[model samples]
Target: MLPYSEEHAQFRDTVRRFVEREVAPHHARWESEGAVDRDLWRKAGDAGLLLTNIPADYGGGDGDFLTSVIMIEEFMRGVFSGPGFRLHSDIVAPYILHLGTEEQKRSILPRMASGETIGAVAMTEPGAGSDLASIRTIARREGNELVVSGQKTFITNGGLADLIVVACKTDPAAGAKGVSLVLVEADRPGFSRGKNLEKIGMKAQDTSELFFDEVRVPASNLLGTEGKGFAHLMTELPRERLLVGIVAVSVMEAALCWTLDHVHERKAFGRPLIEFQNTRFVLAEVKTKVTVARTFLDDCVLRLMRGELDVATAAMAKWWLSDLECEVVDACLQMFGGYGYMREYPIARAYEDARVHRIYAGSNEIMKELVARSL
Candidate 1:
């Protein structure tokens, strides 16, 4: 079991209540509307759920990474996917907190913590996904400003992001060494968002096409050292991948619980499903698999807190747990039989939401490549 202090327990309770009160009721509406309501972001901020790990001086909760973990686990337990809170709190906020100038942090992190400004990192372009070096997005320096021109697809929080950390090739001739990260405000003159994209899963989370047409920003908007963006991404990605593993294991745990509850109560062939030998065996396998996954996930979390989690171990955790999550959730859904196929059922939604864990945070294939290089 993971270590949890009394404070952590109280924080978990807070997140649980938030999920029940703010998320569970209107998620279906958000799903139908193709994105979550903007009000939810403000509410999450007010509830101290937006930036739990950010320092309190910056309007954050002054908590550790475990707080974010609790939020993910609680949300996934409810099959809640409408909000991009994880991407906002754990992923985007950290970029600024870690790499931005002190002035940038002083200005941006407080607004992000309060949900006044939503954040996104735009890295994947139309022609580039895993190949970060191949991106055609260019940020040409003009005197004291950088004019950015490119299109980014599949950006999380793209529809309502107030600030975006866009990855651009500031020195294209240097290949990977030329890449840079630039902070672009959403209302910049040439910046525009395409319609929210529809997906088979994660329907309620806004994913969109972002266009940067000569959007210019002061050179001061550069995040980290100019031309060091790729290395910066490498340094931060382990945490992001570990976050995906946390989500994967949580989904597996919840899926197993839903299946077990169904098997114990549902009658099949005039007998409770749990009484059947095959039913017992299937659940047995699932229980063992989930237990192992939980143990590994906890170990990874500990390593992360200690700053010992490397890219290889993180890649292993991301690819393996995500693959296992898909397998386990699929198995658990099978136990629900016809009911699993219904969208209204939580298990069905869990199945849909679990899919992208492998695809995002770097595809499982690229994860394997990273692991292979370490061998």
Candidate 2:
């Protein structure tokens, strides 16, 4: 049976059209500028394409998790990798929805839904990568406010984020139990964003460095209970890793399609590249991997919707699918030969974009460690 319902199919069509019209056309410019246009967020919000999984009371579309999945899949298929909509809608918004106070949700989720607020999670510090327990950012409580001080690097959407969910240490001596999540508005004093860090892939997406030099927010900005940030992150990271898996499968499929088209028409030695046994064999292998990954990912998505997805399974999907994505994209790019090496080819960009999948959302090595713990 197909994983999506009729409603999901229609939503997918809508997202596909929006990506083609608003996203694909401007991607080159976004890449050149090192970030997508801020107006694109508003447009996506207006189109009911942002925060689809949030409730209608919060200015969201009242859609399910599948709606967000459709959006991610369509965006990847369209090769619109610049916008951080998945992070905003799927990853960051859920944090506020599931953990934030009533006031915080009322104030923040609506803005996020409306695209007036771009959301980012600040977790990886200059010294801390996947080790959330080692984060040194301090959130000192003072009367009614939290004074946050730390530096966060490799923050996605950092340049354009309006609200950032920051992970910091509320108690220095407690280690993992000391971690806390604080909501800091970008306009707050002592909060500064560094230049958009240029990356090898996903060039249009702004990854940046954020410095919080004694930045303060109301104590109400604390997400969930104090000293429970690690728990909250552990609960939420499965979904984040699943999101990466979704991207991996979608990108793999897109790369396969682009390569198929290229090989069918591009002649080599007076014969189409697809006619070669080597080309056919490589593509067949890629197709098999893509199909398997998609099936596993679809199962994971359904489990996620039912609130039954576990951490170990999510890690499996994340690592395996990302590894498959890199392998497939690299093989596909080889078919394009010299043209693939140039940025003008879609396969070239896909190749570059696929490399980072293995690194981010907790490295594949870390995913293996997570899975090994369950074993």
Provide backbone clash counts, one per model. 0, 0
Task: Estimate, for each residue in 34-120, the C-alpha lDDT of model 1 and write its tens digit.
Answer: 898999999999988998999988788899889988999999997898799898999999999999888998999999998999999
The 10-residue segment with the lowest total lDDT in model 2: 1-10
lDDT of candidate 2 over 1-375, digit per residue (tens) = 336788888888899899889988899999999999999999999999999999999888898888977887888885678999999999999999999888889999999998999999999998999888999999999999999999999999999999999999999899999999999999999999998999999999999999999998999999999999999999999999999999999899999999999999999899999999999999999999999888899999989989999999999999999998988999999999999999878888888898889999999999999999999
TM-score per candidate: 0.99, 0.98
Compare the candidates by TM-score and give the number of the best one.
1
Candidate 1 segments whose C-alpha is farther than 4 A from its true place: none
- lDDT at 242, model 1: 97
Candidate 1 positional error at 237, Å = 0.4
